[model samples]
Target: MVRYLAGFPTPFASPANAIPANYAPNYQYLANPSEAGSLIWTLNMELTPIYAIAPEGPYANLIYDRLINALAGQLLQRPIPENFAGGINGDAYQQARTTFSNNFVSRVSIPGYLTGKTVTLFSGQVVPVITPQLRGLYAWHTEILVENAIATAPEEDIARLTDALTGFLDRIFFDLRNFGTSSADRALNYAATNAFQTASVLRQATGQGMQLDTIDVDRSPFCRMDSDCWDVRITFFDPENNRRARRVYRFTIDVSDAMPVTVGDVRSWPIS
Candidate 1:
């Protein structure tokens, strides 16, 4: 059940480095053998195979290394307190260590081209295939990300902002979960992970006593030549004012290539 990269046969045997030259012949062994040398790297959301990762390009070996290290619980590193000692606040240290350890591989941001091709895994479940962009691959801890996002917030606003941002992210991860294949889905996923715009929007809305009401992604009517663009809207509403119009913030993201990017500045206005 829990096997190391060493357990996999050759081609996959040397997991510490470059892609094996013999990887092509082992296509049949992969969960999705649709492409030569494409290995199935399952991206799980709480044990559910959300997408099958097919790391491409010259840095495929690096991608595999990250995934394998994450699986082995070696991807995250937390510095021990300088004052740490045996039996001297050891319980607190242990608790902190446990919490940090549990967060390993809890959240991963993989920006990739979600292909139309689908593959059936060994478990018989079908999932979309994605060729990851090397620069966008990030294995993160949700708590750390949240902390970083709110690190500069005023002390008085930190508590509420933390709650609002955390809740918003939870909704994306659970309620609006998707297969990451559609352009809109890919754009939305990219926006959420990138977090700069979303975090700014969340902070602004929460500061004004508004709640994150809905997140919507739709194909953008405006697009540059040969580019696939989508608009992601995050709306917030005042619970106290039932008749008041909602505030909506929208941004355009282009998913035309392997890596998606925000096309322009985020725009916001009130909408009924």
Candidate 2:
């Protein structure tokens, strides 16, 4: 199951129209507060699952299933992109939309039944019967809100916002790397103990250092999941030599359960 975590704005509340004039644009000069200010905009995502199949036997099936589940859990528990700019209205927003569009088109184009196929019944009669196929894609969407805070400068405010957003994306990438390494290591260790001679080859083939190429998450109101969850898809790539390798795998993670909380240094106190 895919899980998405939405971002939260600071100060808990926001101004109706614009920020206050006294608000400093620089992070260094901004007052330290714990409560949110004003409501800004929200960010959301979409998630889909990717499956890999091994070329061997029943063991291959087992490994494949385990890997898929591992990836799902890893993505759900990891941090996702929190930057609102990188989301809907951000520079990379259009690209994400296009990617999702293509995904849907591809899924819909798949043939449900082969027209020219014939089948033989148990009664020894041959008939042209429609063979239903289940070749389809799985996808989901989520949304998150970000409270807008007044700042001294627009540029400075955007920069700070993006920084916070990138933090979530970075966390996801970090967790993915860790997950891949652990999975590969476990597979290698098992092979070493069970297969002995082939362990070295397997270990070398599935080692780390593989780079993830693309990560695309849908960024539209249509892709939202209520006030706080969204869907996302992340693509992974492998390196063959000094150059880039062919596209290897793709995974989608749906984040929902996690709630957004502002990060700052102000504590709430009661009037004495």
Q: Would you list the C-alpha lDDT of every candidate in the order shown?
A: 0.71, 0.27
lDDT tens digits, residue span 148-262, model 1 = 8888888998889789878888888889887776788888788768765677888889878899899999899989999999999999999999798899999999998877889
Error of 1 at 95 (Å): 8.7
After the best TM-score superposition of candidate 2, give how far the Cα of residue 209 lies from its true spot, in angstroms: 4.0
CA displacement after TM-score superposition, residue 72 of candidate 1 (Å): 3.1
Colliding residue pairs in candidate 1: none
lDDT by residue for model 2 (7-63), tens: 111221322333222221122112322111121111111221111121133343333
**TM-scores of the models, in the given order?**
0.74, 0.17
User: Model 2: how large is the Cα RMSD against the reference?
Assistant: 24.3
Off by over 4 Å in 2: 1-208, 218-231, 240-272
